[model samples]
Target: MSSDPWETLRAATRARVGLGRAGDGLTTAENLRLAAAHAQARDAVHAPLDVDAVVGALGERAGPVVVSQVADRTEYLQRPDLGRRLASDHGLEAGTWDLALVVADGLSATAVHEHAAAMVDVLLPRLEGWAVAPVVVARQARVALGDEIAEALGARMVLVLIGERPGMSAPDSLGAYLTFDARPGRVDSERNCVSNIRPPDGLTYDAAAEVLVSLMTEAFRLQLTGVRLKDTGAALPSAAG
Candidate 1:
């Protein structure tokens, strides 16, 4: 057995904990590990999303690709507001849709590249009978960008699958934001989010799908999302049963 008691804990999670000290500083190995993690986080943030690969993976499920007003990665980082609006309308046809799905490269393009299309694959099967609009792939996007896209598509609700801001430990966490009555000017409080959705460590694809489906069902029934909406953990199967 190792002398370090934190070994078990360290094996259980990705978080940095119980790192031994060396002369009032982290040990060289720990310092190197932290530096590597930081580099990964930075790379996740700076990496450009491969829009062609994403659209190819999604195939017929994908609609026209779009971009936020932000010109590039540098501008996207500097101006958050620019990522919230469309560059132009893109001539999407208006239709009454129950849901509009958007896949966006947020702070971590790595997350979208790894998980967005896979998430849609799992989610679509559960949404049968609902009129879903084509999946919109967006670049240099923020959560609010989905609102304008969904509104233009005339959807009652919008689900934006975006790359969450990378953490030192988790450089590829995906997040989902759902908004009912989606339109421009919808506040964060008017949305519900499902976050940290990376598999084998974070929420699994199937599990996240279950939670999202439950929220969507309730949202449509109640005609709302956000502060008034609640996830009662009712989607998962009971242990007792």
Candidate 2:
């Protein structure tokens, strides 16, 4: 058995903990690991999303691919507001839809590239009876962009599947944001978010799908999202029961 009491805790999570020290600094191995994690987080932020690959992965489930008004990655980083609007009102046509699905390359393109399609695969099946719009792939996007897209598409609700901001331990974490009666000016309080959705070390695909579906069902019935809504995890069966 390890002498360190924190060893068991450290093994149970990806979090950096119980890292033994060398005099006044982190041990050489710990330092190297930290450097690698930092590099991955930076790369996740800077890397461009592969739109074609995402569309190919989603296949017929995907609709038109779109770009935010930010123009380039550098501008996207500097001007967050631009990312919330579409470049132009093209490809999308107005039609009444029960729900709109948007896949976006937010802060971490790697997250979307790796897990967005799989998430869609798991989520869409759960929304069987709903009139779900084809998935819209967005580049240089922010969470608010889904509002404009869904509004243009005339959807009653919008779900934006995006890459969450990369952290030291979770560079590929995905997130989902849901909004009811979506419009351009909707504030953060008007949305419900399901985050940290990268499996194995994060929320598994099935678990995240359950939460999102439950939120959507309630949002449609309640006609709202955000703070007023709650994910009681009621849709999922209880382990204790």
Candidate 3:
């Protein structure tokens, strides 16, 4: 019953558009939906990481899990610097590897809680020949934390599968960051990111895996990530079909 042409755009994206109003404000349904979304975003920020569940989801191919220097959720949001380092040598396992995969509870733990394992499932089979290290499940972590952990594990590259900052429409959106020659001092420009992984919308799991593996292959070949490397190449053999 809406006359606005923008209503057509609403079907394609989660973004709010051409919402019919009630009096001077949103309709009751819209108001309720907005409130619910706000609540979900708030809860996602404070949600705790289920470490055991995550490791179990990773199944037999898991590795030594670890926590970051960020002591708790409170500190993680307040002091991002702490989240970028390790507290002690707890899960820093010894091994030289081509890649280190870390799953971190970023701003929205809900994302990692839901998508990390599935994303891994998609990417792992494609990386059969690479010397991948144990999957590290880091709690209260930031993207840079993978750098320190990778350095400790003696890995040439690090991929951090993390929870992205939640938007009202996508509270459980997941993200990833890849760094070549990972080390403690690596800057943000040294990493490449792939974001918005979920189901029924956003980036599909299989597609995300394809993009990630492509970037990884390129990074290894060129010894760089971030701005220098782009993900426009043809898919790898495993990614095909």
Candidate 4:
């Protein structure tokens, strides 16, 4: 890995950090950016605000907000349903959004910032008349939060772009999950997930984005998703203008 940091330096260059070669196989720019990102992460960790704070803030309020909260890391973890909907609000019934997209702080906020926006940027224009709800930053949220978000938006399809669990290989990795008519009672297997969302990680942002949009578009046309939607574009209607 050390012998081949040329591509790494290019990516860093696009990210707009100064370039310098550090003795250890990594560019000085690479080390500096990583160090800065780590420092920011540390500060965020030490801050009083976190996924818990985000969830609590949502819980304490009442309105048309889609209730998104962490389920596995705090007091709410025990109550799977609370991690679901806000009992007091239940949110306005989603009437069917053009396209619903949820941005969650699943494993790393940095991941979402780095890749989710780019994926979503290209995806929205591909889908016909898709109007994305404001990108909701979820805290302590889970993979299933996409359903609730879809329900809140009353959307035909829900796609959640979140940070993947950090590994030594890729800390800021991103992932995506797409479901047709996602709701509270839906099963996990009902949705299609696209993971490892970074350049040369698993799928390129643009290509993976095409697949994601294609899945939802297919679902809308065929009225199905999951395995039923895979490689089934032939059965779906042509895209609307």
lDDT computed for candidate 1: 0.94
Worst 10 residues of 1 by lDDT: 232-241
- lDDT head-to-head 1 vs 2, winner: 1
- lDDT per residue, candidate 2, 50-163, as tens digits? 998999999999998889999799999999999999988547998979999999999999999999999999998898888999999999999999999998899999999999
Decreasing lDDT order of the candidates:
1, 2, 3, 4
Per model, state how many residue pairs clash.
0, 0, 0, 6
**On a 0 to 100 scale, what is the lDDT of residue 82 in model 1?**
95
Candidate 3 residue-wise lDDT, 102-217, digit = tens = 99989888998889999999889999999998798888889999999888999999999999999999999999899999988889888999889887677888888888988999
Please state the error at residue 164 of candidate 3 in Å.
0.4
Ten-residue stretch with the least lDDT total in model 2: 232-241
RMSD of each: 1.7, 1.6, 3.1, 8.6
Candidate 1 TM-score versus the reference:
0.97
lDDT of 3 at 75: 85
**Counting only residues 3 or more apart in sequence or on different chains, how many pairs clash (N, Cα, C under 3 Å) in candidate 3?**
0
lDDT of each: 0.94, 0.93, 0.88, 0.62
Tell me which residue pairs clash in candidate 1. Answer: none
**Which of the predicted structures, 1 or 4, would earn the higher TM-score when compared with the native?**
1
Q: Best candidate, TM-score-wise? A: 1
User: After superposing candidate 3, which stretches have Cα over 4 Å from the reference?
Assistant: 1-7, 233-241
Instruction: Answer with 2 or 3, whichever has the higher lDDT.
Output: 2
C-alpha lDDT of residue 175 in model 4: 83
Off by over 4 Å in 2: 235-241
